[model samples]
Target: MSYKPAHAGSGPASNSLRILETVARFGTGTTAKEITDALRMPPATAYRLLNALVGDEYLVRTSDLRGFALGHALSGLVAAATPPTVCTAARTIIDEFRQGVRFAVHLMMFRSASLRVAEEDPDYPLHSVFELLRYPHASAAGKLMLAELGDPALALPGGQLVKVTDHTITDSGRLEEQLAEIRVAGQASEINELEEGSASLALPVQLPDGSAGAALCLTGPAERFTAISEHAEAARELTVRLKPLLF
Candidate 1:
């Protein structure tokens, strides 16, 4: 995990970045000599750039050992580069929901006990509340995603839950009880847990095998998202209407 010096030259560094970008776009490794030939740089300069990239963990030595390829450090960046399958399919539903509610609509994916907001509507207000975008099991969407891990019926993985907000449920005992409620209701709700005066309603997006792939959420001011409020009802209705697209 060696790091480059802070005062590296920008001109040559920019060229190296261009080389990495080309390799990534091509989806394969390129030999240092090949890169030099392509970019019209000297062989020694190309080798220096390649080793620099390798040390940064953005590239790995290929099987040939003479070439370099993208590494796992680029995996998270790539995953975030494209919208997930569920989000791509549910875009219409999400857009309409955001338009109708005039509030933020977030699509969250479950990674262990945490919920990561993979997609959000830019036009939707209250953007700062979701600025961090990723959080532990606290919001309605987070809880809905967490509930997937407890379903004996779904046979998903289980692990120690991580708490992100003051209102987060850390105890396994209480979490299991709450998950049961999510299983029965097919949805979850949270009020002022992640942020004071903010609330949300969320329902699991079940895949073809009946396993939860993600959660669909609508977030807004607490006063606007009551238990039996029209906003909540509309979000629930949107979730139901979007069900067919998940497959």
Candidate 2:
């Protein structure tokens, strides 16, 4: 006798499970349209399932209300199912950097045109946790990833360059120039861009294939990061320490 998997075909339960899986795969959460396109499910059906999942605490809408991520219940499930070694290593590295720099540190991975914070310094929070996801164009780590992506990165939704603050670079032409500079400099910095009082410095973690695997960032009060020489020095030091651990 042969047995069939419960999720092998289309049904309310099967589709719900598939939607959960799809959202999980997206490191930075996913939009409704993305779910529809990925699963080839009807838009109405997708929305209904998403709403149900959100209501049942299996999924939670992003802080921007534009995407969905694993909710508390689902996150706990995933945590219980996976090993803790990777999380431990990530936290150790971030903690060490935070201790050395005395600033908030974050580990960000750019995937599927989104910036996902894999780990962050809990002792010192800079901006709203969701702010990075919503305003990638206004952040140093985001600019670094965009620089690595080159022209193709411009097609991402964040490439619209929404102005998050008065200092944000909303003009596409100017933003492109900034990206170029970051590429040449091998690092990126933003002062009062994402927020009025905050600044950040980011450097790329070079992968084995010579591509940017992730971004290591330090953020703090704008006053502390306003000096170019200081920013460069800190970024260089952090990059040296991160390279051995991450790559």
Candidate 3:
């Protein structure tokens, strides 16, 4: 069961990382014996590294405790390292839309259990109130994410539908209804919901896997986006521009 290193001259740390990478590539799970066979390491060395990784929470033992899978920490590391390509494409589109529409634009991604502003128009920055990652029920972008996530997402801790303004939807039941409507309409909108005199229109960015990846939004004075036709046109244009980049 003992063997030499698959990659000669590699240090213990490098070997440890390779072990992790190998386990991830398996997707289902991997046994210590399997790892030893793949890496050509001694069975004792492979078992030792696997035990250490499981101890540190970088890898987790399967239900039977005979195989290893990625732990929460490793999953988080992967998510942090892999920035969604849609965010980059959305940023470019937001910048261009900002120039043409003369409105503040934002690209929001749902990450780490929060709606994060991944990118915003530099020249026309978002107002201070809309800067932080909060108010899911009040902002068009946040509402869009909630709609995509569905009921299970609402059950998460700290996911209360807080009222940010008089217009904000506070009741869970009502909010669910609105989310359903947004899902059907294929767009979301907010008029003075996050802040008085501010309005926003957000359309979902479809990921390659067909899930909602992010929301591309335009925000400005309420008067500017008051017309339903304007929102429809903007959503249509954004979807058309984002199609090639996304798929």
Candidate 4:
């Protein structure tokens, strides 16, 4: 993990920023020792900065307390940031998929547990991504990321869900039930939920550690989609193809 920090040899502020960058790049389970080596910092300096970051809520220790992940305190920064640019290789794959399907294919990604679109199908416009992010329950890609969390309720508003359509899952209980099913199925769907005649199907894009941090979704008129199995086959292949490039 050793590398020179981009903003090193300056002072506490530069040191702190480097520490945060390292933790973010490594994702969850990044330890103090790793940060120290990666940033080439003294043990004392790294520990001091880590403690301050944790106290400020910019970083959180994993449940095991041996590693760290970005914390909710930085949600605002994540919310404002655009999706990471799709690399040439990944873009080529997504373009090929879009050529084969009339339906809209979205490369939905997450950062700090918030949804971002890496690429949206150009042929068919995605109605309102803002609304989908605003109400996760109304979007399959949204629900897919929510299902990956240790507790779905953390991201959900809880109690009564705001109904986006007649088919939207309004009851919190039913939402939980559906999330459970999504976990078992490794897929999520919105059947006339987000809007009348609009449906979406999502298959998770697995991270190296095997947790789903991104989704490969096809969205369009419900009639445009057939059985879930039909969409799942191609999506599963895309997930496999994307794993190395995406992570």
Candidate 5:
């Protein structure tokens, strides 16, 4: 994920903006389940919303039968919508987390209705998976962001669960259960779901309205991250300390 601010070329997004944006961002067709995993909406809600978008011609169905992309008419709308400002507000906190964690750190905004990486540090030498946000249930950041939706502590797009990895949580019932736990715990963790032998810790960035506007994460190899319990503890502390900056 590259850290960048919203530009003038961006446009305003509506409630249904995610459906089109997800397709454009991911650059591939997506299923309702994938949308739900990335956006954190209930399965039924995601299905209904995506269906509506398709019906309205804001999204187009793909040949695979379970994927969608921006409809012909909606492409220009995304280019005009502003990327989002949450990144600007939280960049300091995100950078701090990276410095302390000594690993790649990324911040993802709940944009258009999906999790979009708003920033990533170049010093870490890891590519930000902001692109994967388009592929629901593809990464730890996506799952954490989706989990935050139960509390709307993280703004999320609505869609069904999509499976990206063998370890990825594709079962809606189980994924919901995991999200409930994350909401109560104030954070979430994942191993090898996004990438094999990789682990991560994440927490939601809440807005003044108590909505989760984005998520902050620390990621690295499984060995380095798993051995450092202190890192997890510190990340937890950072999330709590930064709560004021977000909410």
Candidate 6:
């Protein structure tokens, strides 16, 4: 496999980037003439940017100087932007539970105060991970994360908690009270908070420091919340199974 840029587009750097992209797509040993032909850029424009890129270490000339290859400079940029990936073993474990459950099971990792989806159920897609993370007080997984942080205020954005549904907790005092309960109970639940007829329950994958490193949330129709609670033992077992991979 070859290096691929995480970002790309037109700008002052477009011509130079186009040349590098041409080389990447064609792999190493791609000639300058090939780049210009593929990009349909004038020879002068292509050559100028190519030279500038080579000089700046964004590209490198081939060992024989007959072509170009991606330069080492790209390594730093790629490493900085790349997020961690779930391994095969972790996926297998998560998949087994997802296959057995009727609910939308999501595995979310906590990075600082934010929760990022590690994996979402394929059969039932999540409503909106972005919106849920933005309003951590509105979802079971988000509430579990906030409780683990031990400070709801740190996770809450400025102003009142935005009301996604009438059942959503809008008051900080009330949210804090729930967070306290979660701290004691080691789990969190939501009812018609994020959506009118949806509910969820979350159990933490706790870390050595006693804060949650990840969460396993089960979501389904609001009427089936009792069904969600029936799996508390199963969710706890799943979290223990995931502890080796998630944190």
Which candidate leads in TM-score?
4
Candidate 5 stretches with Cα past 4 Å from truth are 1-81, 86-93, 125-131, 151-160, 240-247
Estimate, for each residue in 210-242, the C-alpha lDDT of model 1 and write its tens digit.
777677777778887754245666766766666
**Best-performing candidate as measured by lDDT:** 4
Q: Write the per-residue lDDT of candidate 5 for residues 130-160, one digit (tens) a residue.
A: 4266553556666666665553323323555
After best superposition, candidate 4 residue 213: deviation in angstroms? 1.0
Candidate 3 Cα errors over 4 Å, as ranges: 1-58, 61-69, 76-93, 128-132, 152-157, 227-231, 243-247
Clashing pairs in 3: none
Q: Tens digit of lDDT per residue, candidate 3, span 155-195?
A: 23476766677887788788889889999998899888888
Residues 122-148, candidate 2, lDDT per residue (tens digit)?
Answer: 887556656677677788888888788
Ranking by lDDT: 4, 6, 3, 2, 1, 5
Summarize candidate 6's per-residue lDDT along 1-247 as a digit string, tens digits: 2322333444547666667778889988898878776776667767888888889887899899999888878754554345546778878988888777788888877766776777878888889666787888999999998887777776777735889889999988999899899989999999999888999999998777667888889999999999888988988998888777755
Assess each prediction's global lDDT (C-alpha) against the native. 0.66, 0.75, 0.75, 0.82, 0.63, 0.81
Model 5 lDDT, full chain set:
0.63
With a 3 Å backbone cut-off (N, CA, C), the pairs that clash in candidate 1 are none
User: lDDT score, residue 114, model 6?
Assistant: 71
The Cα error of candidate 2 at residue 142, in Å, is 0.6
* Clash count in backbone of candidate 4: 0
* Candidate 4 TM-score versus the reference: 0.69
State in Å the error of residue 59, model 2: 25
How many backbone clashes are present in model 6? 0
Ten contiguous residues minimizing lDDT sum, candidate 3: 152-161
lDDT of 4 by residue, 1-247 (tens): 4455546466888898888899989999999998888877778878999999999988999999999999877665766485567789998998898787777888888766667878878887788767687677889988998898846655556533778888888877888899999999999998888878888899998999999978888887887668543767887899899989999
RMSD of 3: 7.5
